[model samples]
Target: MANALPLVALLVLAGSAALASATTFTVGDSQGWTTGVNYNSWASSKSFAVGDTLVFNYETKAHTVTEVTKSGYDTCSEANKLSDDDSGSTTVTLATPGTHYFICNIPGHCSSGMKFAITVSATRSGGTGTSAGAPRVPAMASVVVAAAAGAAFIKLALL
Candidate 1:
């Protein structure tokens, strides 16, 4: 009975910790290219989880979170998407765990310092040393990464 109690308590604590670590972040804040935008520092900012999905909500001006490769840094690359001018949404799921580079494919955007980056960490397994896969965490943490600088919400999840 004593051993069982300790085991149960540990399980409960682990579950709670996982829930707390789960986070969500908006892709685009309520601002234009000037200030108060999410993309401004997204490159060295945003975060990701194993099964997290990045929700790109386009509010104004056509934008996209296209995947790119950091010249010298070797990490995960390739996954990307372009925002739809009409509905304005581009969702991409983080299947593997690694760092992903993203930037606006728009002309003058990337050059004008309109670059974004995100780090996707391994998902929290369900006790068996594997990710719990909780529908993707909104994001892992907030770093120097800037926002999209448009009218949109780039949500990162941890699944």
Candidate 2:
């Protein structure tokens, strides 16, 4: 029992770290998804990855978060929406790699620059240790290696 404690702890820690994400971007930052703010510029300042999340925070239902195709995004058309959310807050997970487009389907909103596009890499950034099988962060890999070594030592001592 006592001999197994450290191994258990190591497993738990690794599990927790694996479940973490690279980033959770609050769209538009403090400006909170709204008009007059440059959402594309906002997106440009950050790196997006698979398994990361995007939170759209707005003050009212006057705006929407609409996921659409490149054509829809280009034309600001809402006829073929992949997903649409009118809630003041919308959460979207970047599940796959490639370019993703979002726009406000409300009339005049998207054309007014209330839209943004992001390219999600197939990787998690900044050593997030996400479950997406993102490249192992060197430091985290070291910790995991050390932990494994420690557990092995403990097992040997028990013998």
Candidate 3:
């Protein structure tokens, strides 16, 4: 029974680390997904990870977010698009590690520099992931672990 306390602590720490791995990023920052701004520069300034999310905020009537292939992105082609969203607020999760491309499908939007490509890394440990804020689960887990440790200590004292 005494040996279980150390094992529990280890498990709690592992869980805390895993919960901190995911991150969310607001795409384009304050300017958001829109025209007249340099999307390329916005993308270049940030690092993306596989588990991170990209949130695109824009005016739905004036713009549409389209996920496209490399070829489609290059030619600003809307044909054979992978996905399209005009919700004004689109949340895209980077599920895999690869080069993902997005563009505004509104006529000349893509040609006018409304396109950006982000390369997501496979692992978050390469200093390529953005931390939106502190991981909530880690803090909660730490508190729970501390309580458990206290209980364990009390039980040992009683024994």
- Displacement of residue 75 (Cα, Å) in model 1 is 16
| Each prediction's RMSD to truth | 15.7, 7.2, 4.4
Tell me which of candidates 1 and 3 scores higher on TM-score: 3
lDDT of 2 by residue, 29-114 (tens): 77888999998988887778887788898866799999999999999997888999998999998899999999998899999999
State the lDDT at 35 in candidate 3. Answer: 87
User: Can you write out model 3's per-residue Cα lDDT over 19-112, one digit (the tens) per residue?
Assistant: 6676777777778888898888877867777767888889877899899999999999979799999989999988999999999999999999
Per-model TM values vs. the true structure: 0.46, 0.71, 0.74
**Candidate 2 Cα deviation (angstroms), residue 159:** 20
Clash number for model 3?
Answer: 0
